[model samples]
Target: MKIRILTRIALLAAASAASFAHAAPAMVTEGILTGGNGMTLYTFDRDAAGSGKSACNDACAKNWPPLKARDDDIAGGDYSIVMRDDGSKQWAYKGKPLYFWVKDQQPGDKTGDGVNNAWHVVKP
Candidate 1:
């Protein structure tokens, strides 16, 4: 019975690890790109794609914090990274800088969308 219990525990552990890997730092859900925390990700319409720049900075960044990228993250396909004015690496989708709205209280909150007609939800 002890051996059987150990086997089941091992299986559960493996499953949990797999889920973490699949989620990684970002994932698509319900046709929208979301942060690891499941909060809605958005883009600034004013930011020019491939400019390697973020228009939202200073006080603006406080309200719409960029989805920061880790040092080990590699840009590929539609997913890319941008260097913020502060020299931090930030994740971008299809060349649009990604951000998390501070007003969003939880996952699936899209209060930042269409704000001032500049911010929009990033769709997968």
Candidate 2:
């Protein structure tokens, strides 16, 4: 009976770990740009480059919050991590950083697009 109980506990622990491994990474998106959950979509400016670093910070980051990446978020294809000055990980696509709009209240809102002559939707 003790052996059976130990086996059941081990199985449960393994199942829990497996579920966490399969979880999707969180991303930001523009409602007008992609059809998926707009919260998981991200965008970059046309002029931004994968080699160059980001310039948005401080108050800028308050209005356009960076789509942060968790430690388990594995990058694929054009997706990468940008190290912020605040020592946080920000998700980047094709080398351009991703951001969410403070004014965007709902999932389908596109209030951030075309703002300040910059900002574009991030595609997967």
Best by TM-score: 1
Give per-residue CA lDDT, model 2, range 1-124, as digits (tens): 9999999999999877765663334443432333224543446464266754556778988988887777666666666777777878877767777777888887767677778768765545
Which pairs of residues collide in model 2? 28-41, 28-42, 29-41, 42-122, 43-121, 43-122, 50-95
lDDT of 1 by residue, 40-99 (tens): 999999999888889999999999999998776767778888999998999888888999
Pick out the ten consecutive residues of candidate 1 with the lowest summed lDDT.
17-26
TM-score result, candidate 2: 0.65
TM-score of 1: 0.79
RMSD for each of the candidates? 7.2, 5.6
Off by over 4 Å in 1: 1-24
Could you tell me the lDDT of residue 97 within candidate 1? 90
TM-score per candidate, chains pooled? 0.79, 0.65
lDDT of 1: 0.88
